[model samples]
Structure formats: structure tokens, C-alpha cells
Target: MMPPVARAQAQVLPGMGDGEMTASAERQLGDTIARQIFRDNDFLDDPVLVEYIQDIWQKLLAAARLRGELTPELDERFAWTILLGRDRDINAFALPGGYMGVNTGLIAVVGSRDEMATVLGHELSHITQRHISRILSRDARNMPLMVAAMVLGMLAAAKSNSRSGSDVGQAVMMGGQAAAMQNQLNFSRDMEREADRIGFGVMTQAGYAPQGAAAMFEKLQYASRLNDNGSYPYLRSHPLTTERIADMQGRAQLKPGADAAMPLVMDHAMIASRARVLSRPGVDVLRVWVQAAGTTEFAKGSPAQQAGMLYAAALSANELKDYGVARDMAARLRERTAGNAPAARLARLLAAEIELSAGQPARAGALLDAKARDRPEMMLSAQAAIAARNPAPMVGPLRDWVATHPRDATVWRTLGMLYTAQDEPLRAIRADAEANVAILDYVAARDRFKAAQDLMRRPGAGPVDHYEASIIDTRSREVDILVREQHAEEKKAQR
Candidate 1:
């Protein structure tokens, strides 16, 4: 069988525009790549982290639109979705479309929202400036396929324990055109400079501290100085230049009150700590964080530092299955961050999560307002409701949510589980199929859709909800067409 990366290259390489790739084509390519990423084990959707990142992302997007940097056509065509990865490497990248990815390690290291915004702004600028397409457009002969292969190869290699995938990627990278592959992987120095300049403006326009750009550059400089140990994968792709650092520093000096230091906000501290814990830093590191919370040094630290420590300690303890420690730390964190609404909400969520994990569904349910419409609250409450054997309350809101957000595979799966709990087999099956459809797994979606149809056709299959039955029939036809198109593409690729 052809390796997945090879198959992907084959599937997407043909009919790619010769000279300049259109925005629509670029979006199509991004969609294909995103679907593969969704299937990758490292791809994740940590609600807290996602919500935090999305806050920064949406601001950047709006700022870009206001500045006329984001054209309506491009904005409407692009995915504009940020996919989170579990990789501990400090990296973020912009794909062909507006799709960007952020590693948990990037969030774990930044000291404030401004710093995170700087990184995100840089990535967003890459998309708005059409850097990827411009590079591919420069020469179309082998560029398109080469870049696609390179992207898929890197993704494949990132997969843990996928030796075959790694081999395929290595072969592509180290092949006869190794130099070309290398060039395609990293943006040119000119493109980097453009991204830096535009990203700085966009970030500041979005109300982030201007010093953040320089500060992030300093962090990259520090990482570059460190003996290469693979902790910072971002440096490899971004390739920090002394000239770039100098430019940012000069820009920072030009800004009013440039001397003023950006303070670390309590919410950022907690969010960073959450990112750190979610990155799966080993038990040794987790234990160290837990111990730090009880130290005299921790007491002497700034409120932000203490907030971070407390958050980390609670999460680490929860990870270690030390529920009592988790609870105590969470409560202290909640108290400490009481002056900061966002941080306090995070602490409350953390407390509720611990309660649920500790098998106290009632406590978890009580911690959250059932009417909360936020993704994190809704998701957590849903889980609690399911565990408590009362999934009814979440069903209505979740159903409404999925109706508008049909691309949310996670929510669909959760709703399916809720249906399962309620013994609504037909709805459960349809939800399962929809979940697969959201991920672009048309084969699996078709199978599930067919199964639903079969179930309905069975003798004495009790009177189903007319609404659900009609919806299933419609979706079944849709998935069948998708599956056939998918097969046609595979055959085309083989040809």
C-alpha cells in the first residue's frame, strides 16, 4: 500500500494551478491537509487551550479586517481555524489557507497574552500576505507537489511510533532534491521580514503590547543560544536572524512608553500553566510543580507567579490522581485569582474538572451554571450530565450548537454519547455518522449512515422520530455521494 503522505501528494498534486494558485484552490488544498491532520493522533482539542487561543485569534482576525489586510474574498474562502497539537515543541505554522496550528509548548512558555498574540499575529500575517502561495507560484513545475509532500512528510514524521511514516518522510527530505525540500520548508528571509513587520502592526492594532514582538524575538534568541536539544522546533521553521531581532528592537524603541514593561496578567499565568500541564510533561516535572506550590519561595512570588504555580499544582495533582491535593490547590487558586475574573473562572473550571475526574458528578455539575453557553462550560457540563445519568439538559443546547457548527466532530461525538445514554439508538447512530462526516472521513460516515438506514428498515423498528428519520435519509444520500467522490479521487491518484 502507498504511504499516506504519498497518497496525499497524489490526491492533491494534480490540477494544481500552473502559475498562480487561486484562493479557492488554496482553501481546497488546506481542507484536504486539515482532514489528514484531524485523523492524526497528535491533533487535539483541549477546550481551555482552544478557547484561550481563539480569543487571541479572533482579535487578530478582526484587526486584520479593519486594517484592510484581510480581503473579504480571502477571509470568506480561508478556513481561519487553528488546530492545536499535543507536541511539546515550541512551534506554530500557517498552512496554505488561513489554517494555523499552535503547539501546547508555545502557550506553555509565553508569559502573557501579548506574547501569545505576537506569535499568532506573525502566523496570521503569513496567511494574509499569501506567502505560501507566492512561493509556490514563483515556480509551479515541482513546487506544488514538493511543498505538499514536505508538509505531509513532516506531519507523518511527527506521529509517535510511526516508523514507516518517519521513513517515508526522511526519504523525501533526504532525497536527491534535498536542497529544494529544505528551501520549501522554511520561508525566505524576505518573507520572514515581511511577516514580522506586518505582524507587529496587526498585533499592536489588536491592542496587544508592542513590546511583545521584541520580547518574543528575545525568547527565540535565547532558545537559539541553547545547545540544540529539540525543545524548540519553532526556531527551525522560523529561523530567527540577528537582523530580524534588531529590527523588532528598533521598532519597540520607536513606540511610545517603550520603556514600560508589560506585566504578566493572572489569567495568562493560569492559562500558561494549563498549557504546561496539558503538554504531558512527565510525572517528575509535574511533581516538581506540585511541590513548588507549597514552598516559601512560592509565597514570596508575585500574584501572577503564584497563580500559575497553584494552577499547575492542581492540574498536576489531578494528573497524579491525588484528588485531595488537587482540590486544595484548586480552591487556593480560585481564592488567589478572585480579583481577576478570567483567572477565577479558569480556577472554577479546574475545580469542576477535578470533581468530575474524582467521580463527584454532583459537585462538578454544581460548579458550572447549566445555562453557560461557552464551549468549555457546555462541554464539561455535558460530560457531568452524562455521568450523572441526566443528559437531557445538555442535549438541547448541544443539538443547537451542532446545528450551527456541523464541523465540530468532538461535539457531535459527545451528543451521540448523550443519545446513547438516553437509549435513542437511531439518533445516536446518526450523530455518530455526522461526527465522522465532520472529520471528512466519508468512508466511515457512509458505513454508519448505511447502518442507520438498515436499523430503520428492520422489522418492528419502533416508530422513530419523523424529524430524525428524514434528516438521516438526507445525510445518508449526502455521505454516499461523498464516499463515491472519495473513491473516484483515490482511483484518479492511482492512475
Candidate 2:
């Protein structure tokens, strides 16, 4: 995994050509490549990656209204990715066909949701304009004629092996004395400017303070000045100059109306606090930040923003084993973000955990069961019920949940554990086997398999061994069949 900065700079070509291509052909090629890349990259399926993309996409769609271009069709076409790069450099990029990669380092630097949104909107505009595709089409048409000239120019710097410098020189020599290579880089600059303009519009429209965009750029410029030229790739790709600052100022001057409500300042503060909590290593440090951010002064700003801050604080306190504080913070957050599904879910889960921690498994079970009625997808309820020294009540909900979410191996595994705890060896074995079959992951499957085998060994567990063995065999066969079917489907799609 490359750092976002390195990945952003890791282009096979210095610049794409400006030639045109048939729209149909371009669309076909782009879709094909995008699908293939998605299929091949396992990282795309990661839960964290999925969540990050969802968050970014939601904000981008809201921002689109500012530009007077909020269409369902356009929203459907937009796609993105967050690349986990190995490099520590802060960077991100967006390609023509909506391929966006954000380095983990860039994630580290982002202190607020709006800051992340600003960058995402800026990159999205480049994709909206189809800049990369147009450049590629241009190169494809001109490559043949320019090959000899390019090679000759490269030969002069062959011994030095300065790839970028040679490419720049070659482009200049072959395209008359117009500094074609510089022009190519400048083209990127122009795209950046356009993106900044469009992104600000989107941010303002989405209710974020328009100044946040400029503030983000200012921070980036400041970072660039503090580091060597190569340290910050964002600055390199999206060069910031004095003129650019003035341009941003001029744009900021054009106001539609002052009545447009700005998002609560506490929103920014809370996001920053959450980012800090997540980034910190030790639970103690997380707790400290949470407590510091949840004081009356901090929570007094914006109700929504304060709610967000409290949520993070509660999460951090929970991680630190401070259930009392965690519960209090969660309750406060619930009051602020009333009726918010995620906040409600978090509060319920935290309350149940607090109860369980206090050794009141019965209370935890009751709370979870009530909440699970509305949020049937919650597996924690079943787990809580099992902890109450009873597995019968959990069986029905687990069965229903499994029916709705058959692909979730964890639920199956938990069901198996619950059954085993209740002394139902055969049922546990079967449930565990089914879980292993669905996931097709041997490591997770092995745990369930071992538990089932252990249960069958009990002296009074009559005929359990035979039944467990049969289930193991059946599930093992199912895994192979599923894998083969997936392969077949992929091959068919390729054709």
C-alpha cells in the first residue's frame, strides 16, 4: 500500500493527451476497467472502507445542491475509494472515472468532517469534468507520431535517469517551444482551481461555512511551507500560490445571501474531537480528550455538534472501562440528537454494556430485547440474552436475524455459542457449521467446529458426534461449491 501522496504521484504517464474519443467507446472502456479493478481489490470490501465512502458520498451529494447540479443520475454515476497506503505522507487523488484514493496519513491529518468534505468535493469536480479521460484520449491519438521525438529527448538524459525531468524536456521539444510539459502540469492546476470553485459552492450549499474550504487550503499551504517541497504531495499536485489565495478571496466575496444557516461551529469542534479520540493510542489518552471536550463550555455551542462530541466522549470512556461516565455521556448525546438512528443505537448498546459490566445480565437482556424489537439487526441483544444464563429466548431472534442476514457469519457463530452454552450440542454443531459454510473462512469456522466437537464429547451427549460430523462434512462441501459458483459468475461476467 502506497501512502496517499505516493499513490497520487504514482502515475504511469507524466500527463495524458488532450485528444478526443468516441463517447460510447470511452464509457465502455472506463466501466470495464472500473469493474475489473473492483473485483480484483479485496480492500474494497473492507467494512471501514465502505463506511468511509458512505460518509463522504452522503456529504458530497448534499454539497452538489450548491452548484445547481443535484441529479439522481449524476449521483448514481459518482464512485469513490479510500486507499490504505503504507506511506505516511498525507495525500489524496481523484481520477476521471471517479476513482478516489485517500491515504491513511491524510485521514490522520483531517481534524473535522468539513475538512474531509472540502477535499472530497474538490477532487469530485475533477471527475465531474472527465479530465483524466480526455487527457488519456489525447495521448492515445498522438503517441504514435510523437514516439520518436520523445525517445530522442529521453536519450539525452538516459544516463541521469531523471524520469520526470526527461519527460518534461521531451514534451517541450516535441510540441514546439510552448513548454508543453509545463502546460500539462498547468492543466492540472486549472482543474484544481475549477474544483476549488465548485467545491466551495457545494460546501456552502450543504450548510457548511464557505470559509472552511479556504481555511483548509490555508492549512495545506502552511504545511507546505513548514516541510520540504516533496514532504507534502497535496501541495505538489494542487499547487497553491499567492494568486490562488486572491482568487479564493474574490470568490468568497460573492455572496448569495446571509440568511443561509451555517452549520454549528460545535460541529467542527466535535468532529475534531472525534478524530483525536480515534487516532489516540491508549484508552487513558482517549478518556482524557473525551472528558476535556465534554465540559459545559464545550457542549454549550451547537446542540448538534455538542451531541457529536458527547458521542465520541462516551465511546472513548467505554473503551477506557469507565462505564458510569460512558453511560452519562451517551445519555446526554441521546438528548441532543433525538431520534437519530445511529445515536439511538449507540445509546442502547452502551446502556446494555453498562448493565452487563455491573453483573446485571438480566437487566441487560431486557434492555437489549426491547431495543432489538426496533433494531432487529442488532446481534448484541442475542449475546446479552445468552449472558443472562438463558439461550431459549435468544434462539427465536437469532433465527430471524440470521434469516434476514444469512451472509453474516458472526451471527451464526454467536448462535452456535449460545446453543452450546445451553447444553444443546447437536444444535450448536449444526449452527456453527452453517456459519463456517456461509463465510468460507477456515480460521473463523475452526472456532465453531472446535466448540461443537467439545460439546459432543460430553458423556451424556448421545449420537451428537455423528450429527456434528455430518454437519461439518456438509458445510465443508458447501464452501467449495460456493467458491466455484463465485468463480463461474466472475468468468461469465468477463465474457
Model 1: residues with Cα > 4 Å off, grouped in runs: 1-12, 143-180, 492-495
Best by lDDT: 1
Say what the RMSD of model 2 is: 11.0
TM-score per model over all chains: 0.91, 0.51
Clashing pairs in 2: 1-86, 2-85, 17-139, 19-138
Per-residue lDDT of model 1, residues 1-495, tens digit only: 112342234335336556677897677667666777898787889889999999999999999999989999998999899889887888888887777888899999987788899899988988898887776466434544545556555555555365675586675564434345545546789988988999988998999888887788888899898854788877877777889989999987888777788788888988889899998889999999999998999989999999999999999999999999999999999999997888889999999999999999999999998899899999999999999999999999899999898988899999999999999999999999999998889889989988998999999998878888899999999888988877776565444
For each candidate in the order shown, give its overall lDDT on alpha carbons.
0.83, 0.56
Candidate 2: stretches off by over 4 Å: 1-56, 62-92, 101-115, 134-187, 205-208, 221-233, 257-271, 280-284, 290-313, 321-495
Q: Candidate 2 on 261-371: residue-level lDDT in tens?
A: 335443344334444444434666676657755477765656655665676777688667778787787677667666766546545665676667666777777666533
* Clashes per model (N, Cα, C within 3 A): 0, 4
Superposed by TM-score, candidate 1 places the C-alpha of residue 10 at a distance from the truth, in angstroms, of 9.0
Best by TM-score: 1
